[model samples]
Target: MVDSTLPLFDEMPPAGQVAAFKAAFDAWLAEQRGSGSLRQDGSVAVYEDMWEAFAAWCLSQSPVVTLSSLDLADLQAFQSARFGRKSSDLSLTPRYALRLMRLIDRVLRHHASRTEAVANPAAADWIAANPEIRYADAAHADPLPEYLSVSEARQLIAFLSSARPRPGKSRDAQAPLTWQEVRNRASVGLQLGAGLTPGDVRALTLDSPVSQGSRVRERPWKLQVPGNGNSPARETPVAPWAAELLQHWLVVRTEAGIAGTFLFPSTRTGKQWQKPSQYECAKRVLEEAGADSREGGSFRLRHTFALRQLRRGTSPQQVAGWLGIEPSKMKRYERVLPGVIEVV
Candidate 1:
């Protein structure tokens, strides 16, 4: 029944009606799935769980939850509770829970869309303000970011330079070194030179757009990287050396008869290989480079690049953009480097 005093078109189902509402919501969710709007990007189930957790919190309330009864303050309360920002049964850890709050907002939006109800004002506020960078346990001392020494970094780069370069503009960029060598050199180059995550290097396409400044300077090339990690698709700087290596690899890749959309497609599968294979390849490069197994791995390549940038006096904000990570996350790298502003 419609209530004239109520804000929504229909009342949020009472406790007895909660079961029915759940069934109906499930039906709506199925519809969303069928329509392909609720795309499975690995977080769909998590959203559902978050929604169910919100519902449980509502059910445990003093006056009980309903359309009119659940106001803006109530929504804020739920946001706090879910992230352990307030007292609740949700076990979400403080580290990732702040990020998880956005998913909870998404669920509420879906509910509001289906029910024609007043949207969660608190969630809107949280999304707008995006909350300050308040991590849990602020008192804890952070660990220093790991990095390779300049000598080791040089060794790492030199070790991966297996492709033989060809001279002359008329010739292809590289001579025979097998397709695997081409892929290995290019892969490591991007991680170390461009500060790209391993996944980003793998996901890069042969036809993926590249942007370069016309002024013609060193490291002028930047890749419009596809979305990697939690970051949106953003332009990432590619050092001149890495760019040179990439052009060379393209020639060898063609010679080896590898054809795929990916910049470094697997010769066996014609698609990007997973991290396990990437790790194996990285270990081989490290072995050849004489880099300690404990010190150098696939991810450490990115860390080395990031730390170098910090050492070069780039601001944390700038480095964060370069590496596709949160600015606050850069503090770990910053703690190790002394007086960034004074470096230049």
Candidate 2:
């Protein structure tokens, strides 16, 4: 029998039934809290707060209510009252409404699983109907990369290799090369030219191979190296421009006498640099070089490398092996990169 005294619902039950239900519900909630199923602290506080707000809104409808006693119609009415109606200042979109409804349903199902009575099927049906509510298409908004054109790539290399164009005044010689400035430029080449991830760049140690050659090899930190999903180990090649920057950085590093195992050490800590440090350095370099920060970061450089390979008519299987992604994933990049996708 249902309890009428429960403010949320009109049905009333005997005192014994109400006492037994309350005891079981409290015991079940305690179990969930102990099992780490119902989050009360940490990052889950925000979610807890949101659920409590929904509960408060439901309770505002009537004072004599309990969660277990609430039916689908009452819950739906609460949802409609809070989210369906629009105010002058702001209105809840279908997406936001779905988000809250999902959370509410999740808690309700969890609670129902602990009890004898089954949860309402109508709420479940409503959830099934509102699946895949996307607020925006972020994928289409991503812009094309502003990479170094083939001609520009060659020009930049020549500029770096060449001496003064006209032998200007002493002003040129007096310019100070801040350690950070040099590292930033090297970051671009290492990522764009070498196809190294930001983590790979950070984990670089002084002992890393920097010999004068196009085929310089270095094993980045284990974390930075890509796992073959479930396969054996493999080696990825270094790009020519990546090799050039690496070669130049080696000369500067040797002169500085920086003795840490880490190729990039934090000036403050004298410790090997981490991923965030390397990312910031790379961002500065890309911004300075007028490259789009969104498109020319380490991942974009890797994308460019894969795209170039695909454009050259390399098979998807071969490109997949090089990029350490599944073959099907490689096809997406090929299709996305302009000029690489050729429909037969």
Candidate 3:
């Protein structure tokens, strides 16, 4: 059993380089833990086990794969040996493969940071340049995301369109719809029409719905979805029918005198709505529409929007742009395209 606490030598022979690398990585992990950067949790054990397994594999190689000679090819060979079809007992699922890849990349990056001589083989740019390094075993990939059928979507839209707030009494039944009801309709409409995530919907300002000086009630309303570190800002056109619902809400919003910049704010405080409140709103709306509220959250609404575009002869790349996701992520949506038989 190799002791991880073993101190690395300034110079080591090819045979002992792997052990030295492991020692350095272990020491780094310990330092991180001591600094409160890494938690003392099951995840630390996972990292240890994965690194030990990888180091052992390196020692077992015919030429003894060492730190100095380690490169993309070496990593690829190790991945194939451990996870490819030949290893029936240790065949890798996509999830495990992804985790393994992440572990290896982190370890390699740490090693590179300490030892300037050794280049990190798993550097993001290098791996991106060599796309084959990514686990692309489509056969074992997770199933396509769930989305609403056309009929279900239509039903949901109809329910939202005619939905009115319940009256307090028989005489008050003729009262107009509340602003909250209109806001809920607009929120759901943005998700179902523009493929906006709940975060995207929450991040919107009063001016988000307007596009190129277009008015609130205008046709072809383009929604400006704000972005964070992961995705860039994008503008997507809301479906005309959904835009109509949104228009009604915008009018109600102004008249209601809600004192917030956020397009959807708390009805009472006019502050940003909490995540649970948004989720509950979506759930209640789904339940009211007789849709599967259990599995059909805001994400399902976005997925439905994606699927709808794909089914309507829109290119996957175009749809991906609309959804503010990478084009590669759209591959899953392609599985459900018309005439495409989805293999279980």
Candidate 4:
């Protein structure tokens, strides 16, 4: 087996060159880790694994051992070795290989800039020349995102509302819940009501604002506020139905003795909120109600609400603010997906 610690320098390098290269790599890695750029996650692990494979293949081909010793010929050979190999096919995609190379290039470039090493130019050039190339568009069919029509949305809600609860007295019992009828309606209402995301809904605590007569407030939606990061905060208005459903949920909360910060607690636990679980439950409800639209799922509720707001003459800027999206991103929603909505 190849020595994992071997540097990529020629002839295994002199003791001094090996020490210098190791020192440079150590320092660069420290900086990346400390600066929060390099996450110690599966992505980084996969990149490292590919790099090890490439390094091993290079060592097998040439006497070189340190990154600095790698040349254009070695780069080409590494790509060739990786291309369509069994390991590559089974463990990695071409995209994965390309990503690994780019990550290696980034590390090398960082090291080169700091160390003023000779490898910088070649590494940079290789990265530029063989960047994980891609076709402009996907080769596979691009099924336009499935979306719900207004009528379909209405039907979905009606179906979910009418679904009988499972054979039990518990409200949480399995029932034909429709997004339109309950979860989807509730989701759309919350989004329209308070401009909340699936995350925000999960994060909503009892302390979140509500109406006595006709008012609502909460910390900005999860995606809107800057607390998670440096992103700016935005406050958006909620639609009437969202406000009502939220109010209704509060009533259910009281009966369930659901006391906590989370606004949308699990019907089972009634004490904690989980976005994925709730979404899945919502999907189940929709499926049971037979509310599948051309868009195929409840994601269209969000789309429908946004499109409705736009068709009502809401400006892109306003919609963007409401949805907690950058205005540039709002341009895509200016026109609703075909069959997803009708003009009021």
Highest-scoring model, TM-score: 3
* Least well predicted 10-residue stretch by lDDT in candidate 3: 123-132
How many angstroms is residue 317 displaced in model 3 relative to the true structure, after the best TM-score fit?
A: 1.4
Worst 10 residues of 2 by lDDT: 129-138
- Backbone clashes per model, in order? 0, 14, 0, 25
Candidate 4 stretches with Cα past 4 Å from truth are 1-146, 159-185, 188-196, 212-233, 267-271, 293-296, 337-344
| Residue range 250-280, candidate 1, lDDT tens digits | 7667767776678777664567765546655
Write the residue-wise lDDT of candidate 4 on 118-163 in tens digits. 5544444444333233211235322232345556656654553333
CA RMSD of all predictions = 16.8, 19.0, 16.9, 17.4
lDDT of 2 at 28: 49
Give the worst 10-residue stretch by lDDT in candidate 1: 126-135
Residue 86 displacement in candidate 4 (angstroms): 24
lDDT of 3 by residue, 1-344 (tens): 99988768533336466668677668779877989988968878877887787787777776777765665567657766785455455436545666666666776767777777555554342233222334354354544666776677888888887643333544246556677867887798788888888778778888787745656435438887788444678988788777777776776778788887888996645799755567657666777888754333457788888877776778888889888999998887777665433211
Better of 1 and 4 by TM-score: 1
Return whichever of 1 and 4 wins on lDDT: 1
Predictions in order: lDDT = 0.63, 0.52, 0.69, 0.53
